[model samples]
Target: MADFPDAAPLATKLRNTLIQYYNIEENAWRIAKKTKDTTVWRKPSEEFCGYLYKTQGIVEDVTNRIVDHIRPGPYRLDWDSLMTSMDIVDEFEENCCVMRYTTAGQLWNIIAPREFVDFSYTTDHEEGLLSCGISLDYGEVGHNFVRGFNHPCGWFCIPLKDNPRHSLLTGFIQTDLRGMLPQSAVDTAMASTLTTFYSDLRKALKA
Candidate 1:
């Protein structure tokens, strides 16, 4: 929907990343966190670390309703505590927007806030399968927000055919939180934050 100079390439990368999540080598990833309805796995490499999370038991809200709430736009603040603010820089279509997202650093007092712009696109691939990707756009840098390059994240929602009242949600993200913090600290913080985030989401939706 949104037209950008690099939209095509970004979409390709997003698709590839989605594919990678499904094809990730079993030996390469280890369970970092788990709950009754959610599990998060991590695979660390020299350049960047990848996280894959799967959660079921979310109330089967319509695909569009869930997507609207999660997209990096104005509504994000209502559910995401890590997000300080989000502003839409440009909008191309109903399902595509370029937005600037500011997230508080894991260590609020020590680390500065991280900010980046992303070309976010969402589509219903088919009935019962909804996916969206937010790919980093390095061209624009917002004030007071540091750029963390190559951090792309996305999610997929697949409704169960037998029971339309529930769906499986999977999310993947690759980030380079550039800081002096130890790798162990980063991993622990991320794992904890992610688990809490999902738990909070469930509560928000119920409310």
Candidate 2:
């Protein structure tokens, strides 16, 4: 049962950080993995010991609809395979809320299931929509799950000017899955998980 004294400042910071990440030059990131539908890039994180991953792909949907499926909501839980469960712990004005969620183990459970409490915000950006969040050190860790921290993670969905039916979906993810896991395992799991995310989302939207 932890809470923020004020959400406005936190929301503002999250939005600004996400905008900055979106503006990062392409040369700063090195390609980590590429799939049929998505490409992932990674760079050393400024805030943590882990790497910040960037994933980009063209989604066959409008910006608003795509954002709906990504933001903290039922649609997200229904589509995101890594997210096993989610609950809204607190709600604030202007599409901001606190979410408690658990992720399934990756890399054949070598990473172990992890839980996080995050302050999530969804807002309009110059391109289209930005959905972002940062982990909070709130609540006691569940006995069965390791506590993980996310550092300034977000997604920007922008509509194509010529083809309004399609949108460019880009994401920035940096998760510190705290535990005794090896760095190599974490790196492999993250890249694989991110690429799978895009394929799953596309299938969900088509369904």
Candidate 3:
């Protein structure tokens, strides 16, 4: 666990904090949402948004292991770090680019360089130094919706109660933004890509 850099300690810290926060189930994300230190309690959308943002690769690692543990492959465990700035799911304001935070009667737009939006975050990978522009596809993050195959129950996409014809993605969402763009551009462009990712995931699942 110690060998995996931020993975071990963060998970441990997250686990403990969650217990104190929810005082219910010890699921991974419920804890994070409670401890976020944001003034307004974060919505589930925001918490998963942030988790998929930070631990972009962890899901695929767990997924691949689950698959490799079940089905072998020359498999690539995908991870993504892009954040969904906001969601206006109702009919009137769908797919609008909402900022990640709304405070002091304003939406906080996370200003960032184009490259950071494309590749890597200056705050994260570069450790406060300016990156020299790595690869072309550095920060372009992706989200996916795959059908379940012989896995757990309770996660199937059940259509909402009011709208039985339309379905809800009860399964989960995952992202993989590594090598998608430049590390420096990650800050500015996360929102649009996130919107696109959500749209794409919904479409993919519906198909």
Candidate 4:
């Protein structure tokens, strides 16, 4: 593990988030969508849970390739339609960066463009497993974007023993999309977002 001495507080926060990510139980999640090689699940919470959404997914991909695509700050806009721009605001370690992401609004809806800052850390632990943790920076806010809160996300890639070229890509995200949008609409949008993101990533890897 790399030392982040200058940003010790942020490193501690990231470590805590990683611990929570690992503690999430599979049984607590309900299936939202499933395909031949991909499965997405959601964990419903009470109104006071401080989290509006919690989603998880597992998909097949090449471990290194997927990690490379996801860990880069600028590559996200290529595959994530919701993200219009991403800028690296700071760097603590070689594999850890703080980024600001601007999201596009749904044209027909009341939701406007929002921005969020997150501290992201990536580690290639062991031979074939890549792990990353992202925690929202509640203090950072842009002029035209809403400051995101209570959102902590994680990504992991585990290479398959049966096939060296293949891996299982796992991700978890808990976000509070602050707005008056119906829960049903939010659910649909979240599901579609992940589906489309993975599809685009796969296509990009092939290209």
- Per-candidate local distance difference test: 0.65, 0.92, 0.23, 0.64
- Winner by lDDT between candidate 2 and candidate 1: 2
Candidate 3: residue 62 lDDT (0-100): 20
* Stronger candidate by TM-score (1 vs 4): 1
Candidate 3 per-residue lDDT, tens place, 70-183, comes to 111122112112322222111112111111111111013233211211111111111111111111221223233111111011112223355444433212222223333343
| Poorly placed runs, candidate 1 (over 4 Å) | 1-4, 25-27, 45-60, 107-111, 134-144
Model 1, 13-114: lDDT tens digits are 776666666566677777888877677787654335544443233545665556666776556788888878888877777767777777887755455677
Candidate 3, position 108, lDDT: 36
TM-score of each: 0.81, 0.97, 0.23, 0.79
**What's model 3's TM-score?**
0.23
Count clashing residue pairs in model 3: 29
Report the C-alpha displacement of residue 136, candidate 1, in angstroms: 3.5
Weakest ten-residue segment in model 2 by summed lDDT = 1-10
Displacement of the residue 163 alpha carbon in candidate 3, Å: 3.1
**Residue 61 lDDT (model 2):** 92
Q: Cα lDDT for residue 97, model 4?
A: 77
Ranking by lDDT: 2, 1, 4, 3
The TM-score-based order of candidates, best leading, equals 2, 1, 4, 3
Mark the regions of model 3 whose C-alpha exceeds 4 Å error after superposition. 4-159, 164-185
